[model samples]
Target: MKKLVLFLTVALMALPLKVKADEGMWFLMFIERLNHRDMQKMGLQLTAEEIYSINNNSLKDAIVQFDGGCTAEIISKEGLILTNHHCGYDKIAELSTPQDDILTNGFWAKSKAEERAPKNISVRFFVRMDDVTKRILGVTNPNMTEAEREKAIKAEIAKIEQENNEGGKYTVSVRPFFQGNEYYYFVYQDFEDVRLVGTPPNAIGKFGGDTDNWEWPRHTGDFSLFRVYTDKDGNPAPYSPDNIPMSPKHHLPVATSGIKEGDFSMILGYPGRTNRWMPAQGIEQNVSFAYPAWVEGSRLGMDVMKKYMDQNDEVRLNYASKYASVANYWKNRQGMIDALKAHKTVEKKTKEEKDFNKWANKKENKATYGKVIEDINAYYAATNEKSRHDNYLMTILRTSDMGALPYSLGSAFSQYMEASPEQRAEMKPYLVNGINESYATLALPLEQEMLAKQLQLYATKSTGFDIAPYVKEIGSKSNNDFTAYINNAFANSIFASEEKAMAFLENPNADVLNNDELFKLSSDLIRQYNTVPENVKTLQNDYQKSYRLLVDGLRKANPDKKYYPDANSTLRLTYGKVIDLPRGNKVNDAAENWYTTLQGTIAKHKAGDEEFEVPQRLIDLYNNKDFGTYADENGVLHVNFLTDHDITGGNSGSPVLNGKGELIGLAFDGNIEAMAGDVIYDPKLQRTINVDVRYILFIIDKYAGATNLIEEMTLVK
Candidate 1:
């Protein structure tokens, strides 16, 4: 039985350490060893089933879709819920007023009545999906012409949907995972009453803030709490005073005595994206050029934004989010590059690729397999040319000057330049077919301003041939200093870079700004982008195509492998018994991992510090027997749980469950070393950072003294 399972795994998976479209080379084996199962066992996962049964009395009525975003499992008979702190940032930020800094001070429901309302926050659940893979692929045989297969599959999916009855509130989403290796259908139940329940101040929740972001051996307490509500009829509704808490099937017990290193664990939530199956060349390009270049460019741009934001409070407020987003991705890319350099993930992968290809060729699997891999690699290589299409198509990497004028122009012409044929069907009259919408989003000169800052930052931070030499070499474009040139561009450009534009914005003399037809046109373009986000539609279609190719291919070749498609932003079951990955010996005198300890924080604390010190509650908990149960190898309470769970940004609110499928921790950030997994998933290095349920419970009971919230749930000490 083990051999059979092993064979099936190696014959069908995207292994953590390999790139086989039809096998789990190493990852599948690893997961199997952890006693993890695929979708077949998903139905048998009682916790998951219990979650499903909450919305309805039967699993049959509980719909789970793959396309669903913001995954939420029913936690209690009354709709009290759980998710990550960062996931609720937008809602918290929205509800916070100028005088009330919920982000900094944090907010907890004093009682049920104190849960703050957020207009835009939402929670969604998977409803259902009809496995239409056979119908989808039936029209396109592996032997069929590519064009013929494409047409047939399209017709088939449409037909399937047309024939099936869909719940009015539900929507069908087809996602591509493992590149173009697979596809799956997801149905979802979206609710609008998500509210902020509790969040630690940024000092703790986002401890170390951006500087510590995307880093590992991390100490960030990245959990924020929220609650879900439903209409009186027990359905999703926009937030209203009349709305009440949602009814859930279960609320996880707070495991005060937390997990041991080798215990069973699982993370169930919406993981954004993972590229564990890219060909070697793709890896090379990323490590050598793509990631490094993007990181450098982003760092420069961020420097500029920081300067302006620091000096101007209004500017800071407006751009804090924008800064975090770019910085977040930049941090991830840098981490990946660093980790790739630190270890031999790329080398091992390359070696494995060679072995797989050699074996497949001997088995006569090469003729077709060889060409496909070759095509993907060659196309990837060709597209990544430094100054050409591959990595430099937009010049956005090397040059971050994002002026509004250019963007406005790009958005205007994009009506004709909009790229996707399918997306073209839904394009606004002002949109260009091939042009990117962001080009016009900066018509307000947002890009140019962003670029100006980027250039200034590069000028200051970089040296050698990379940036310093370039600035020095520009020598003076048109009798102006770089800064002056930038100012002129924003002030003079037709993309509304003048005093009049600002004056109009301040008071609103749109008639003057739009006296010309061109102004009217640009206004319409901006309006459309703000309203529809049309580009999303086109991108979605491409993913659908990519998904179909990948999943359909695997289904045809490995039907008996018990495949679980790559995760869509939906509720997924990825189970694994926890395992410790020791990178190296603690330098005889030093600790191997930088955990959040009283000693570490106390030593680091200083007078008049910019960041806050560790909360006293933690110190008291450590000194007293206040800690309920969790402890590390040294018997110090492991206030946090960490693991190499395959995860990403969107997995923020994900619930890290024990083998019993009870929530043990809330999935938040990845350790600094694990950032590379954002671009490259190296099981040995990438880890998910979670707040130990015990620490949280202790903080609530012994620290914050919030016994009411603690008493509401079953906490197993």
Candidate 2:
């Protein structure tokens, strides 16, 4: 296969002597061969084996993929887990009620018996990973079409996963890398009985909120604590009274010695996705078309949700996690758009493509490497409008529970209707419970407004493309106004209320669902969103082929440069040092600018302000200088710090380790100056914003007075 040849061609080349330490999300399996020496030179004290060892307890064993989204690390022998507060926001919100609004006031389990377990929360410990590129490539050839090649590779991957899973003892995943030129299978052990131990109040945990999210000199105490439980035999199990805290293979020791400029810092975690290898045309499409629609759609959803949220404490608790999620990405997309344009990223990628094209078109390379850029450019040109249209509809489904009911609940209802009586009996409880849960958190007025506004937004913005047919009909008849139509539909539809829905479940009917106006609207939107013209599918496939070749060609063209695969939620390591950026007229000085102290936090406080309000207790403590031992040598409690370590979305909550593999900080956010870091790493400007470990300790020990938690941890002074 051409892809196989491409993989081999790059593999056969000698490894580069050195690589920029701050730039890569590197695979653990290749660390010794590819990066160990460079890392040692950059002050990494751990051996490669100590960093990632399949044969022994190592740093990898302490890190976990929290809820399949963020990273968390083991901090105690009793399975104490430390992760970003935002990472645990959903579970915290789920466990919150108006009477006991722990999400707003914060929660702490003084004893293990008080720890609350939220349903469906789990953490995955990375066991090991191995490259299977050659095996995956062995099944297909150059003449095979993309579809055929994918089918063949998937079949082999299934076998590989089955073989490694050890009879369901582990969760095994085989993932494609470098645009499918390589493959690797990762093994993990999942613990389902995770329980929340403690969290600071919203005013503390989410101090700066959206206003300071991606900004530097941040003062957010973005950390939460949970504990993992296991069966008596130390095997993963569901929650039980008899279960005990897990004794993890390894746990990071907490470091309170403090940090300074140029101190070694490292992060090991799962970074979700990065399109660093994307072509110039793809970047242009995202910046100019796709992201703008996403930003607008997300903001509409946030506005609708926030209006209801602010009206009642219960509503706020119910929508807290959802609102935070939408708001975060809404800001991120806008920042990405600004950063991409400001950094001239598209122009840079375009220049790189031009250089690559020159090499690819050379006589010896033309037959195999030519046409890559042409196909990529043409594909984006054809799909730009479609991408914009898709995102607009997608945001509605993402934001409005009612907008997604047809797919989520309706699909379950369909399954119930089609099942045999025995199967229906087995599934009825789950189906009924699902409907009850959906309506419990959903405010009818809020859902109606969200769906109507999102549909209106979609109908108005997605011009030149066919809007969802039912939505279009309503919009046209009402001059793009969905208020009346949506109100009438909610008044009549069974899905709008639990009583109406349960009544329908007593005697489910296909005709009732088929003729429902709300159902029709949702069904139409889903259908249109999913259906792609065959010509467009062809273009997408061609784009995939060309993109793969482009990545491969770039590697071949630059054989002297080291290449690391883009992140796809797999465990990876990135290392660097404490770093600072020049701000306005100030020189880049870490001692003055690398970290934000609690004093700065109080300085920014605006009384009664939602995002900037400081808790009275915290303010009093700061005024009294009651920081105790959590303060630095200079007696200031640092809230957050900056590092040159590379990270992305899923890296949130990852442990920032000092040279001795001691936990010093928790990587939470990245500065806005390098929002384009997902596509291009800017060493001078891109920095990982982290919650200092001492701040976490102060919040737990002094602020919350959870000294039991302090006793559990192994603290290094």
Candidate 3:
């Protein structure tokens, strides 16, 4: 009897698991079928069609993919956009100079014409989405090789995209979902003339700095304003002096009525990626090998940058965004490692896979799904053995941005060498442009130290000796020290000089690159690095095939259950409620409220600490309880709040809307306790941190004195 019960439980693995209301990053198109009933029960007043409609203006129209990464929302018909401050951090840093430090002091345009129009910043609106699963899968079958299957699917997708493009006006993409078991086509219109409208100083924008990052009782006013400009006809266009503000089809109305402990909330945005279906072996490999190296490499880079940034304001402005970008993920990886371990994520995944194996081995389901689990495990095992070397090398080459310059520049030179004379002439200008752009950001003193540091670590730690030839030569010449070698290499290398690189490009010769030490080292490193991981891609391809089969078989085996595809930088909607986490459920047992207020910011203030310092005006406002109409019923000004909305990295700056589809807050970070959300969704422990809309209004209206910007928003009391 006990055996029978256990067998039944294993058989259930083939069935779909019920998703919690706050668990899934659901596709907007399927809300009516999959989630609308649950959402309506949770107090959603808007219909599914109102939330996501292709025929008419809907909430979906207001949301935009900010800068190809974060999310943003249209707040007014005039195309005023709102997103997280960190989403705009890179642009702010790029625009800042010692003489005009907009990042440190903050900037607010009194009128539309005064706004700073930064180059290359763009916002993309989701035009529409359709499931192309049948059209994609109909082209090929399991009998085909993975490469052939992909080729066939790619052809179909190209045909579909071409058909739906409506004369190439829309940017179209066909992305695979559910481990390639499904596919969806998305259309977007990209507006390139996004301009910075207003932002608070770094002190307010990044209030608690890294210290309060991913923490609960947050006070960060992590919001920034931008505007989208279009052609006179309201079509997407490049930045032009004649361009006008876009008149969007839909815009979110700001809600000032405030929220309660369990008020309904929804997050709509392009959630980057999640691996909820990742096998136990995959999680173990990431936690044990890949993530640790990334964390270490990023920390090493940040330390070098910080040392230079602190001493020179110019360097500080230049590297601030870089350091923050690295530091954000460095800590996130550590958090994920800790959370995954504490949650016993691998054990849970192992049990699921074991159950899946049992179900797959059943007589009725034996043929197609029989070896899926075994095949997945085998591929993971083969890749896991080499993960350490792959991760270490990748972290150095990819994460250590400055150290990888030689390889990047060399790749350009190698292409030039291979190109025909005509092709070389056409590409020469691009090479010069790249070198100059790289030089503007590259600080030789910092790069030398960073390169030497990574080299020493790589030599001591990594098992592969692909870079040993260059390291050995440098070591022999410098008497076993890398500093002198790096110094000499940079001092004499054309890559380190704009003039030398340009001069070399003018009358470039393949022999000159062959003789150049840095170029040769870069070429060898690129060659060897490419050669080492050649097998891993094949293993991953096989895994993708097996994984798709697993998902397909599981779905067929259990027609009663429902499933949502994993996030892949596509528009997804996750809805829940604004609520506080219960104390002791997390590693930290601090009593966190559902929301924070201006009073909390005051309490956290320290005299001169960069992280805790409050602006004098803000302090005075708090002291006098002068928060204006943005204050809640209790006369307290809210700063930030917590929610259970399922969000990930790319959900940053996602609009948090009320039951009536009114904008209430901006989704910024997930709690540290739920950092493992990418791998395993912890419904009970996960919390989405957001900056309260009332707080955004207070800062914009009273603090920044940007009443002109405020007047552009549609507000609801």
Candidate 4:
């Protein structure tokens, strides 16, 4: 049984990652969330036999993957899909200029032809996912110990093919969780082109901005509308004049009712990773070092984005997604840090450890738990030095240092070089024009600020680097003087100088043959910079292995228990009833109200302040309808809902459906209280925020008067 548990831990925790902390009592919660057959009869859900089949083969081909790259819920008979406004903001924003702002004013086509093309946006539906886990893992023995287990798994994956992924819709991977406690597999389809649909201005889509990001009882209209399209016959294809909307048979109806507290809800979409079962030391790294650096870095980035965007409308428009993306994590990280601090996650783990030890000491329970807890800690401790600076810096290094410069150059340089004289003018209004636009000016400043913060944190917290003295030297040099100096330099950067910026921006046909200096330099730097340090990569890879080992162990021990894998950017389902859970006792939290209401919003309102004042647009929208769409018993507008659906990054556009499969709300963001929810998934803390669907309709119906959009939705109400 002991060995059984160890294997189970690794197996179960291995897949798209299972058991974010919220998965506690998951088996019970999922079972509780399960609608009885009679209930299913009314709700239009799978019957028992169907449910059996569905559960047996979650990877089967009932679901469709969006080919062009955005997550969408097919909500209409004619392929009306629902996704976040921000998700499609870019297409809409790009379509609009100073003369037309779809982002601010919004857009709705009066008819099908008028729906307007969204440049290159597309969607995909998965045909199938195979459980190659048994086969994938079959290369190794279940009986193999740690080192031997590692070697076999590597050999197996090596034989699985690395290069010719052309036929691989997406790599389907099987993963273990909790030291091999259980395992699961994921299926995905990737697309490079996606476009915008409709979006409310930032004032609505991100109403409260950074101030209100992760709070509950908050009213913010975070939903946007988008539709996935493809070629006429419904197969994935590049953009062309003759393309048509995707016609999906499994489309959701738009009129699903809103959920009240305790209504069971399910989220269906891709999720990223979570580390729910880390040891005390691992939690310490997250709480003290990692969380702080991330929060600080995000705040710094926000500072840079806000300063530049505030100054330039073009900058704001260009980096709309960038701001929201960073803010998303910013709000959550702060919330998570606060919640974990208040909850004393380490304390909980400590108590858990004590209990486990008690069981381990007992003759019967000893084998099952044994030194598993200790080993988890030991492995995690080894990563501490790397986790500090490397954790935060590495993420930015890949995204900014590596991906940014070259893209900026390419954007400014190569597109229109070969365009025929007339075609150059034609391409100007589209993607080519954006080349002259200096997003690097906007993005790099923000990253530079973030890097400054990270280096400081690294100097303050990280250890064992012989660069200890160099780290300190670098840290002190990066203070205000350094920032000002760098800003001055960046402000006058070659890209910042419009002489060059415009030269690249205006030339629709500036051709670069094999010898463009900037292009070659960029190419060389990208190669030189992106190479992860051998030591760091080795540590990260080993960490991943040990992490999987733990997961595999858990799966073997708890075969009877339902276990889900951690997310690895693949579709998954987490079912639970909507219920408000207590979060921070410090800032402001309540028992019955999981949602932050207008009352709470009002409490935090900065009446005289410019930065935090409620947007007049929101106030007018509120006044016009007086909580126009829906209201809680207290009569305050309810902006979001609280749920235990385990989620992460790719789960962004998921529709949070009730037991009856009604589209009550669109899951957009999570409350700040559970930012730590990603790593620790604390059920008592994390809550999924949703923009009430009815509010979206009311905005369109009452304010925007875009009746066409209103007409498109199949309203259940």
Candidate 5:
């Protein structure tokens, strides 16, 4: 059997002694060994055991995976969860009607009964984690192919999960780290009966909107409140009127003592993917092909959705989350492109790879690591040949709702066909409900235009792929006008009408689907889409294998250097100090500070500009300085502050803790200057933009007048 050797503990002597404290997303498990002493020296007052412990309730129990994407932390013993407003955006939108419009006017429950319970909303609490490397590696051999090794590892993981889950009472997953160099299993307890507690209006929750999203000196109060409920026994259960408020094992105390420059700050949350070890060629492909297509397609889709959204409040509410989600990445991709070029990231990676290759070519290491660089480079070279066309097709396939719907519906319908009669009957209501909900959000004119535009882009830009032959024939018959062919297809297709779809569902049959033109188009597109390009997966496997070996080689080469696993949606801890960025080669030291206050927010107020509009109630409070105890010594309510804490996408709602483990802020965004931080960390320019916890309290107590919610929290002065 081939064993996996992980560099879990790197010697302090292996690294430069004077390294900056702002770069890594360190794992909690190694804190005692690797980070505790430095952290204590940097002003961390809590012991490593206090932060993470299996024998007792700790900080980890207070954090959760919010709705599978963002992070949230418990702030009260009754399980009041605080997360980014954008994280709860869709749920609030779903609960909103034209009459209620919670998303526009904001919502605050006066009592427990008044709170709204949205379906499919849940929070996952981390129970425990165990290193499962030996068990997984025990199932594989060096002679096995990549696919075989993967299969063996998966089977072993499933076995481990089955044995550890205690009969589905817990959610267990074994995640790979350092490119499969290590494995660890995390067990979680999920709470399904979560309710919406409160949220500020869009004017506050999304105050700066797209323009101020990854920028500094932001004034957005990007926070929302929810509460977890469970059975009387405090066990996970589905939503029921009988359920009671949960008493969490632990909760973070809110700090109102304020912060100064160079104060210690830390964040712990599940950060999503980061490719810190990516080869130069991968960066080149992302910049040249993948990211550009994603940006263009997302922008195009957003434009179509925006036209409808602007004209109708209901449409706006329905697509608000979708638009925000798309717009975030569109801006992020643009920033990444600009930053990668500006920072010369590819050049940096190439130099590092050269050094790695030189080290690998040494006599003792030659057999195991010598070919890694060559293999990775060749794999990327071959895959990059069709990368452009692949990206264009994939973007259209993913972004254009009209183009993707039939295919999505078809996949479900295909499952229904293979199901037994009893099973088919069981699946009917769900399938019908899905079709209805999907159709309700779609508009024919908007969808038609989107379909036509995306197909045209795909046809013109992508060379290797072909559109459906039937559709192409129809277009050729109509003087090569895709518009006519698509219009006719919509007119004749069952998918274009909910009534027709429902009518078909009353007596579902395979022939009806087989004969449907839209279904044919979907089938054809999927057929071509599934056809694996020659050598794509093979080269991809090569790249992954070589990448793993490259990481291993680096570990061997620099045995003394500290090594933290790349972010893979796992809980991580990063600590740093709050600092102001230099403004054009000099720190902006005009008493402007590294934080923003309500005064600055008022200064930027433009009455009708959507991005700059301040709510009237907020204005009133600011004018009167009625921020209560949430204001600084100067009586100004701080809105946002900058910290050097390392964070990425899924850390959106992570609680920013002070030295004493008190919640001071919520990490939401990263400054544009460090947009390439996912690939390369830039200590001087990188900054984590956080919404000050005081601002959250100000909005909840003063602006929204939801003092009932504030009394539940433990506040430290």
Candidate 6:
């Protein structure tokens, strides 16, 4: 075991010390050894230690994982955070009311007292990370089944996490890299008292709406401000009046110097997930079977939600976050479908796998890797139709709150009913709180339509698999139309309304819940989703082992290629240069320009347009040339720019820094042409779209008049 670990470690270290200019999400711990010299040659001015030192303040201290899903950066000495407006959308919507609709009108905290802390939102600062590969692999032998190996690893990980968590002061995560061939544990300190400081109106924050999402030459002011608060001693604490703005170890300096094409740029953030090492068959499964179902199901939910959201402000507020999430993924999946097919991704991967198979068939290597490719291909081929069927049902649970309630809140209520009087007394308040919270975001009419339409789609689209039995029974009784059945279910089920739910809670009855239509359907759907055949389970276990071996074997086979692990919601650095794509008639801008400015934004404005409406104040400021000192040397305010830095979903709100490690922009989106980037990095087409820092300042100081925020930041003139 020791020899194997040593060999693996030595192989990884001995790989040619090279760095791709704009393609890899690199681990910070190895940067000094693998990337520092190349980075300096390209234009980096900061030492590698200055970027990720644990003994001293470094750039990593300012970067945080925002609310677990996005990235954010500390931009002021007082721990002011800067992130994409969309990343902050849920909190903004939660803080808004019809009378004080910050989601529509925008918000600026004139004083710290006015900043609002939304519940369950927290920022996690990376404390440190280190390799744990040897410790993890020490417990398992090559002969162990995948399931046994996973159990052994989980036990080892728990011990490691307990040892490094500093007695619960830090959140510890042991993440697999190179498809479970290597392991690294990250330590994070979570600050729960993050508060909203400022944001632009939806008209500016989401200027292009669905039509312009993922496209280039964007003018969206996609930035928001927040602040992290701590106890007086600068320790993490829950929200309280006594808590003070945190004094962070480091905060980024805002660079007033504008960027240009071919200038060096770097992004540091927690990018969610990428399947860059996926096999050819896996790519086929996603593009052909899985994503189409997801796209269709998402569109159905969006259409239903948007109809009611358009009619009432309250409904819109409740559904804003949900709707945005579905809509974004709907477009993204469709784009992935088109992009994957257009780029011939599966074909490319197939060729690579063929080469790998040729190398693996050698007599010396045959025993280990001989069956790996065949097993992976067979598993995916067997599951393609099942994958399509599963995604359709999964989409319902993802999109509709009611569709998931039975397994979540409804199941809890059942347990509460069965509990002893003393236990019930203790659980009742929590149950009521859960009910109220779920109902707060639940719009019955919208949910009903969404549930009904999704059921219809699932019944018709899921051709090979048996859907939930209750759903099929309902369909049969209603002549395959689910509207009347769902309407009747909603009318009669206690889960349908807060009033009925409260009444039921007052006098709990198991029989009543058991007989309820909505509960029965939800339970049935969840049960079907969870149930897997024994054969499929065995195949899955086999596939897992083969996949891990494939990754390890690939590395051993190819020693000269610069390999980096796929992104897995860990802090990573990707450096590149500002770059441009040909305009190609899609954007009404100069063909050679890499950035969009206020003039082009005004040109696209339309009065009363949901997507293109420009705020009068913004137009007035533009007309008056009130860009202040935020404008470029050309005297124009750049709204957004492009960089060829590798990034994906969770990289939104990541600080785009210059060579000096100064904040230049916030990465918010990627070009539509490179939608396949999550699966494969394309150097020629992939571009990271960033909201310019100058534009962020212009909105705060000139447009919104939040100079209080400006005064807090350290700026480079």
Q: Which has the greatest TM-score? A: 6
Candidate 6: which stretches are off by over 4 Å? 1-19, 588-591
**Rank order by lDDT, top first?**
6, 2, 5, 3, 4, 1
User: Which digits, one per residue and each the tens of the lDDT, describe model 3 over residues 622-700?
Assistant: 8888898998887888888889988887888999999999999998888888889877788788999899999999999
Comparison by lDDT, 2 against 4, better one: 2
Candidate 4 residue-wise lDDT, 1-717, digit = tens: 000000001111332233443353222113324433323443436433332233343211223333222345766555566776655655666676556766666666555666655555555444333334665567666466656777876666545434323476455454543444433443344333334445666556656666665555555666666555567666556656576766654555554345577666666665545556665677787677666766666666667667877776666766665666666666655666777787788898778667655655567645544655665666567656555555445334322442245445554345456567697677666643454353433455555665444445445544543223433453466642334543453444444344655554554333432334323333433443344456655554555554554444444444555455455445555666677756445343223565544444444556655334555655665556465545545555555667776676556667766554557777776766667665566666667777667666766665566677766666775
Q: Which candidate, 5 or 6, would have the higher TM-score against the true structure?
A: 6
Q: Residue 281 lDDT in model 2?
A: 88
TM-score (all chains, Cα) for each model: 0.72, 0.96, 0.94, 0.73, 0.94, 0.97
Q: What would the per-residue lDDT of candidate 6 be over residues 1-717, giving only the tens digit for each residue?
A: 000000001011111124468888899988898788888988999999999998999999999999988999999999999999999998999999999999999999999999988999999999999999999999999999988999999999999999999899999999888878889999999999999999999999999898889988788999889999999999999999999999999999999988888889899998877777788898898899998998999999898999999999999998888888888888888999999999999998899889989988999999999899999998988888888888999889888888988667678988998899999999999988988888887889988988999999998898887778888888888767899889999999999988888889998898999999899999988998887878788888889888888888888887777877787789999999998876667764533568889998998899999999999999999899988998878788899899999998889999999999999999999988999988877888999999999999999999889999999999996
C-alpha RMSD between model 6 and the true structure: 4.7
Quality of model 1 by C-alpha lDDT = 0.50
Using lDDT as the measure, which candidate wins? 6
TM-score of candidate 3 relative to the true fold: 0.94
C-alpha RMSD for every candidate:
9.1, 4.4, 5.7, 8.1, 4.8, 4.7
Candidate 2 — what's its lDDT? Answer: 0.87
**After superposing candidate 1, which stretches have Cα over 4 Å from the reference?**
1-76, 141-167, 177-182, 214-216, 342-367, 386-449, 453-482, 492-564, 579-603, 606-612, 615-637, 674-686
The segments of candidate 2 whose C-alpha lies over 4 angstroms from its true place after superposition are: 1-18, 585-591
Looking at model 2, residue 158 earns an lDDT score of: 95
How many pairs collide in each candidate, listed in order? 60, 0, 0, 98, 1, 0
